[model samples]
Target chain A: MVKKTSQRISVASLDDLVNVAGASQEQEQQYRYHICICVAAGCISQNSDAVRDALIAEVEARGLEDEVQVKGVGCMGLCAAGPLVRVDPDGIVYQSVTVDDVPAILDSLENGPVEKLILPQDIPFFERQQKIVLENCGIIDPEAITEYIAAGGYLALHKALTEMTPSEVIDVVTRSGLRGRGGGGYPAGLKWVTVAKAESETKYVICNADEGDPGAFMDRSVLESDPHRVIEGMAIAGYAVGANKGYIYVRAEYPLAVERLELAIKQARWAGILGNGVFSTTFDFAIEVRLGAGAFVCGEETALIASIEGRRGVPRPRPPYPADYGLWGQPTLINNVETFANVAPIIRNGSDWFAEIGTEKSKGTKVFALAGQIVNTGLIEVPMGITLREIVFDIGGGLPDGRNYKAVQTGGPSGGCVPEQFLDMPVDYESLREVGSFMGSGGMIVMDDSSSMVEVARYFMEFSMTESCGKCIPCRTGTRQMYDLLSKVVAGEASQSELNLLVELGDLLQNTCLCGLGKAAPNPVVSTMQYFEDEYLERLVDDNGSADEPAGES
Target chain B: MPAQATAETSAADKRWKLVEATMRRNGYRPDALIETLHTVQGVFGYIDREALKFVAERLPVSPSQIFGVVTFYHYFQMKPQGRHTCSVCTGTACHIKGSKALLDDIEAHYDLKDGQTTPDDKVSLLTVRCIGACGLAPAAVFDGEVEGSVTPDLLHERLDNWLAEEDEGNGEEN
Candidate 1:
């Protein structure tokens, strides 16, 4: 197959490329037959390559290769139904496609329709989704810049660079009400504005792609599926903050994502959207890839920066945030992968337009790596104000096997759990915080009846204890003490005093830990105790015959 | 020349050379066998005990530490995996939904054990922590495709057909 380079447009600079692509009058007609296969890290692990090859072969066998293009794309929101394939321009989506189903799908592709394979109503999974951060995902080929361009990928960067002043861009983002998706919920626009106003000739924009949460692959999916979007978002952030250099602190575990991102960076640079003077304008900006050692704590911005600087992946006390003194003692802007993904849409759609979609306070969409007890376990971009009920039932297809919804754990180990009682609550920065959960990097792990809340708290505490950079007394000793107490609770050994002490220690860690990692380390314990105190009481009561026995006897 | 002895000696020498190179690349002391194996897995993706033994012969650390390190981290694999790896979630939620039965069906169909590769090396089976797709309990990830709400009977047929297709590919490639 000869590579089609004609569709590829080259530009002398980033500004020119963004201008031309943004203002391009000609819109390429949607392909007659478009096959979107999920190639995100999750689906890729399941031999999506074989599925892709099977689909390709079937398409070719049916002599529809010319008319139908089988494109390997990112997560399609229904990860539970992957390796997922969607056939468009018909907008027919197929889930759980195996190699065996290839011939039937191809036969249907030629025939009128395969009623069984066609997804229902695009279903609530796709229908209820907002798709801002994941807008290009499952729609555009991640490796192809042209596909991204045709989908209005870099228009945000163009607008930020050419039209809007740096302050104006920051103001728009600020007005749009976007917060840091990386657990802190700090205003993104405020951070950028701070970095912009900070007295420094040299500043930096860092994309936090070091996603370490066990169930979270949202960052990895975005990096692998829509890398250019991230690059563009970072470029726009750099432009907004008056920073010229940026770094993507990606985890080493995601080799494929890292490779794709590196390739995307190269392609962007080659197209003059990244290197030297961007788009024929004098805005010089560049990005480099920095692989992080697999330290969960390094997901913290300061630790990430420290890792990039060749220091041990450890968090330090933050009197000065990254915006003030970061990355070689320079003003820095650091945002999580999803936060960066939000930039382009905000710029393209405008603050008011973006603001209109979500809740009054939390504007724009939030992309969640919906895992754990959720039917449509993949990635989802939902409007910020969407209630947890909507995300769980409407978009996520509720729980499978007729299981009762227990609780949903958001923001990974650092974030707290929201019990089913709060399921109807709107999921915004403030709303989630109100219910004891913060939107930490959009890792939403749902729990069911069988999942022991005590064990869950213990599990997260164990993770926090192991990953605590051991930098401060509050986090280091507090996490260990809390983990021990949670373990005792899980093992049915803890008394009321021990449980109370766990909560007390959790509060101390939340109040005085050195960085965000240590500070939020106690979220699991606190949230579990708050919502599932009955489970702790049940364990303490000992329904089994060993109530009077020693704790370790069993 | 004694043919068997000579071949063994040459193989030992080759293994020693590979270990030395791996150790140097990993920034470990030449005598650190477990460190060498970890580094090797970091580079090569798995550590067979034979490879571990060969490294242990040259390094000071015992094979037990090498084996322990290999088993410790989820990243390290001891055997050569298939083109795709399928990790089934048998966590409490998944198990309640017949995940064990699904595992049994897959094992019987593939003629493999947990953490074992197929004869053709096209697929391997392992159990993992809840993939966070509990809503789609009884989930199995083949290669990286997460298929949820899986049933034993369905998985059995799926694997058989997938293996057949892989065999066809191998035949075509050769």
Candidate 2:
């Protein structure tokens, strides 16, 4: 009787936790200077903790402990210049802060600013970036529920629940021109409407945090920096899509991200944003975290659903999409982290406000985990219609050490490489697709002059081939064969016939592959062939097989 | 304590008997000891060489198979590790960008090697896969910290502090 009573109490508490919403507006306004140190997975590995310690020591040493509160925050997106530390309420952003600079920063804290460490707002990198998704990053302590509330975190969910209907929310999202940031560019609102109208007794909302794109850390950053926002977004999604329960399918490799998210879920439940009747409304919602076992293919929706169900991570043919039948044969709505992150802002600020920022086709800002040879590499959230040149040159601060830009590989292995000629192209979903690249989960790897195009193509193909789930013949066989041809080309062993065969195979795989993974696997090879065919031709061996032997080969 | 001892004894006795039985069944050979050990480890998560040798004494396969298989996968370990293991990426990209300096700082400060554990068995330092953020090169993984673009000065200060806190925790436990 005692155990049963306790269980009932626990269930009631859980229900109360989920239903609670609306961050209490009452917060202390006593000014305390915040020093946010980037402790995202990327910056932490770089010893950002030391930077934090140094800042704290400096503050204590100067006896400014009362005046300032030093804290560890999530990624500030300028990953190339980590460990990033930002001083507020001045909003003086500092990049690549080392232990040696701590004393100087503290000394300047009293009088003015550390001019040397200050990230000038006028700089192209900061000027060009129109941060929306990353607005809270470097501004608030990620773990603090109150800080998130103070920043209007749960207001969108509150508004959606109290003011709008499910169809109304979908209509706003659809009218705002938001598409899936998961590289598919599918209409997000339309997808949600389909799941809502599917007449299923049970439905699921899954946040695709299993970001497997190589060189991409955008989703991970969001999870680490502001987990509450994602929870709020997922809650909003749950309310809109009629999903009683939600699952965040994150990779096991992201332990920090997972830890923070788990904490956020607990906090959200406590705040009454996640569990039973959210925001005092009749709508019910809950979320569970399903960890992926480090399978790259699990990023695909069907495979992700399979992995969630405790099955081997693999993709299946579409027709019955996850919206129609998913997660234990129930209708499901799956959206990437970035896509979900956009929900609250759109709801709070209105659709027209969100739509005014980018191109007609693509609305709002897109976050890119800017990586590779580019300078100022990190997480960057920029307006959608911003040109590739602005992202690569202005926001990215161009290639490191004045190296000439070769090509920018966007959308990971599945996305194509845009050559220097297309640098001026506006980086929206449509514009990127026009040049054979899709804005896949926002992984932009900028290559310099030293980066061999042929080698880059082979590298991406190798990644796709290894990650292919072998669900369909075209992808399973086609990717491996293309990888072999690219490898031969890299080794200067390929004849003209092999090159033609590679192109032929690329086209075939694009058309015939069962899912998105296989369909887009040949993107790297296709784009490279389109732009750098000469590089492939140059690698071709002559009639004599002796030329096929790579340099230094026995 | 007595129950634990009995369980251990029974486990050891059972494993020994199984090894002997399997060896007798398979026609074991002396040279095939390591191979048999690897096969046993593959089925299980770890290797008990006595069981391995017992299997080897019966099987036709060479012991080299066991050694080869043990060394093949990154997951398999020859010995148990400390509670917390830190792996620093020293790939070509990471190496070029001062990862060597950071590694050296960690080694000198902690008195560790590529796969060596601390004297107290609190922390172990190892080298591993690229950690995949080549853009933020010079990366390290503390348990699973996934820090990127690390430098020697920062590594020394942070690692020393972490180690000191760990030592304090150890003292409390004792």
Candidate 3:
């Protein structure tokens, strides 16, 4: 029962909208150059806005406003070398652009390219990515809804509403084999099928944008850059699942993302893409954004529901999963931000198209936030079967200053570290599990020889300890005890017996924790011990030595 | 009653009216408790016990329950803020890039631990887990403005500038 405020548009009207939005772009005299500046959060922090302002000012000052249009776009991926600017038609990119270089850049636009500041466009970082989710990210103006519609945004929703049945839409997704990108690799289609078949008039859809992983910013980047894509995806999900109301539970830390998403929702509603009688059909979908209050555990489904329902973000035991009973005792379809972002594409392009991209089991590209000790640190969406070496060495440009690569930590606190021995292994859900890590939310932090593996374990353990919701005893107490032991080990104060006890506690926590947060809390410690035992043994006190003084001490 | 007491009561009445309006706009649904709390905080800068009690009565939840919810979430502040706030990120990327050393520098300067406001209420120092500026390692959020690649010298200069700006605004010397 959605209260539709605006006039409805049919499928023909939606097509008309494409023409209207497109015709305007066509009428505008074709600019000689479109200088796109990367104004994403990563670049904004590095003063890309100033670069944007300066470029615009110089363009105006040079009387090249019509010929050269400078616009702010989303992340260009290679953030380590930002603030970035890309000149289209020529496909020339500039890195570390400053306001002082604005005049020089404008001059270069008239003259030949500036060689010193030009960034190589043919690097593995750009060449390796398959941009399905990020297709319109650095290209379109996210704040403009007409721009989104012109790019065939809501056509999938129209197709689903006009041509395909709900079951047919579900079948297409099931065939695509798109798994949840929010840490847990649950199949997206199966979850949709469950919620769609559930006999509930009042159903809910949730987009979990509570991206709490330390080195991860993929969701935030997507939300800020191309919010309409997520909105369109959610709308399609709502129609397919028979859900009228949706909520995007985003972290309050991401104010920019929240702002952009809010704007997108309003714009979509104004376009009659959301709300009642969508495409003049008997379907209604309204989305509201709920802000997460800085709780990492809220990323869990039940915990996310609890937070949305105005309670402490604590996880409840499932069986009775969100698909069956959730959010005020109604059936709910909860998917991650990235999962929803993948939906419209799967519908527009046939399932066969998406299925052909990745490995036999795991299909499509996985968006990874590559950070830490890597040279080309940024966001990358690689096909599922890509090796860790390609991600770390080829795409990431290897470690900085010729440092020796030690290990790469995947999945944040919930995932494990993969050492150099497994560099050639393909990074998929199964392969990562084989090497003692699960693909948790696509946070790949590369560590070099200068980093201590034991300290890395302690660092992740510390995150779990602080973020645990104190709902279950094992996760709450076990993480604390584990963190204490790790701190002692890092300080060279732990004995051999203490090291043994740490493993025992890790196993205990893994078995007894109430939810995924607790269950996977010990992953970092367990995987570190599995791969880097020599580091732990070196820190442990000798059996013959005095217990007070740790190993390597007098 | 004294005139001063009457004026104080009127101010209190205004705050309650605003809070009630926020609750009403949210359809007075029980699920709007978090939104109500966020609005109240936005108005008052922090959720005081009086405001929490008022919200409990309006939303019809127990005051203790409202307090529990407020305390459980990290974003909700229970106390008043200082003139300026600076938050250093301690995410893994920042950690590797020397955020702890930056935090230590701030602590030494302010003589305060993480999440503490200075005695004179000039500044508040906070240490957050991550602000998602991984590419710009060792980042911080100063009064909602993100600063990346924060060195000790840069942070000190920024803090000094913030203090000077506050002094100019107050039109007084500390």
Candidate 4:
């Protein structure tokens, strides 16, 4: 296979490859209107595939197949009302589309946009988004490599292999100020530099796709929508880190994402984009997929490494981090799926372009899976430092059913809930931590006034209790104790002393857990206690000093 | 190994051969334990004692450690399953959207608990957390197919039909 194709394109072919491919594709398929249906997981659940088929059939029946082409693309981000269909060149998007309404949609293509059926594209939900990670999403056929090539995929890899030195590649990422998007906001450049400078004969790069955070689908969407982009990003990372082998550790629960990624890898290999002498260079890199069997703690780097090594997925203390010693006792570079997704743009458009998008400290955009009680429950990528108020009210379409907003939980179970008072706070790494939350893998769940804060705390505590790897005593027993205490408090059976004990235990878990899973387990409990202590007081037993009464009569 | 050439033992021989092939494909290293287990589960729905021992021997890991790895992960099933399986999402979003009610409804219908199989071996029910489809809260994975926004009435009807179809097929087989 290597000998059959010319790898001699090398550094010289880097500049013209993508431009030539994209130009030819645009010239060949110059349709008047392109009908793109949202075939992401959210819309697919609402039977978007049938709606897509109906649109194609309608176009074919009207003999407008050549004029109008219907294609299935990734998430359009307005998932609460789906299946969403967008007509390109006209910019008319229809929401909650059904097979019955396909004719009216096609008719609107001829006459005018349907008033009731058309979703307002001018709304902040679509307008306020700064999409760099999701640049080609919802616009390209993910299953086709030619479409990816036409969309300028692998251009960064070609340029990096041909133009930039390994250290120069690392410097560009460092200047971009790109932090890790997988919960922890560690600087990705520092990690890459350490791995690049590691004194080892063999090194490995890992793309952590085990998106275990509840309500987070950003990684899955990226992989499903533009798998080649992640591949290109990873290939570029492999080049910069001086590693020739890569592994993508994705959860097995996402069967669709796994299938698409497998296909993308195969296509890249067949096109000579993944194998040895990629872009006609001497560098040889191959990627393999490893499936995680439903372990939440595997999202932790050490635990993920253990899972990849075919052992019980458990975390060890850090010092000899994966960069220094990892994956069968060799130097390994690990980054979140979203972190790698941001690599190509930084390399192609230059670091200054990316550094200008977000806040002064947190550069570039962040993709979040906005869901729960929000009217526009879907995936969205917005610039860093965007306010929670803007994300929830403007982008998320606020609460549904005219309900009053209560609080929004960010970073899944590892994060805290921010009350309406902090709605205007900018959503950056420092701001989130200041509010007692960490940007954990981009799951922002909105809670309405109908929700009970105590129950929410108990829910996250239960999650932590169940998902604790039980490798150490503190996490194993501490999460269980905290969950029990929260349950008792929720049931109105806890004394004031027990509530105090719950607070103390939360502090204990905060300071003394083995891994991030246990360390951040008590975030929900503490944050709810901080903001909604009145709710807890209301749920407490009577203060009459009776048998059921709490002793502390504060 | 070639001594067992009888037709009666060919099925077992073929299963062993596949297990061997999967182990070899993974380079027969201990690092391929999880992948090997996944392949074994793909071939056989549940990892039985024989399967675990076979994986341990082929991957060169101790049987006890193999058992530890299998028990550590939530996805691995140790016992044989019923004719059908259904997993209900109990994540926070699903819980807020009344997944508990759906579970209660299923419990009443099948006279089973959250992680139990009916005495007739017709169905097994399990509760999981957030399958990443929060847009469709109160979701369920029935035989590995995600069905979202599931209501009690809808779930009951679907499960009833699924059971009836299985029974009809069983009746025909008989």
- Tens digits of per-residue lDDT for model 1, A1-554: 11345434666645555554554423323346777788875666556779998888877787876677787887676766667788877777876677888888777766866677666755787778777888778877788776687677776777677788988988989888888887677888888888999999999999998877766667877888899999998999898888999999887667788888988888888778888888767899999887664567778888887767644566776769889999999999999888988888888888888778877777778788777776777788888878899988988888878989989888777788899889888888888888888888777878889888887877777777877777788888888898888887777777666667887888888888888877888887788878887787766633353453333221
| TM-score of the A-chain for all models | 0.92, 0.92, 0.96, 0.95
Q: For residue A7, what is the lDDT in candidate 3? A: 19
In order of DockQ, best first, we have 3, 4, 2, 1
| Top DockQ prediction, candidate number | 3
lDDT of 4 by residue, A158-208 (tens): 889989999999999999999999978899999999999998889999999
Stretches of candidate 2 exceeding 4 Å from the true structure: A1-28, A57-63, A543-554, B1-135, B138-147, B150-174
lDDT of 3 by residue, A187-304 (tens): 9999999999999889999999999998888999999889988988888888888899999999989989998899888877776778888877898999999988888999999999
Candidate 2, what DockQ? 0.13
Question: Scoring each candidate complex against the real one, what DockQ results?
Answer: 0.11, 0.13, 0.70, 0.67
Alpha-carbon lDDT, every model: 0.74, 0.74, 0.85, 0.85
TM-score of 2: 0.78
Rank by lDDT (best first) = 3, 4, 1, 2
lDDT of 4: 0.85
C-alpha positional error of residue B31 in candidate 3 after TM-score superposition, expressed in Å: 1.3
Model 3 clash pairs? Answer: A183-A441
How much does candidate 4 score in TM-score?
A: 0.94
TM-scores of all models? 0.78, 0.78, 0.94, 0.94
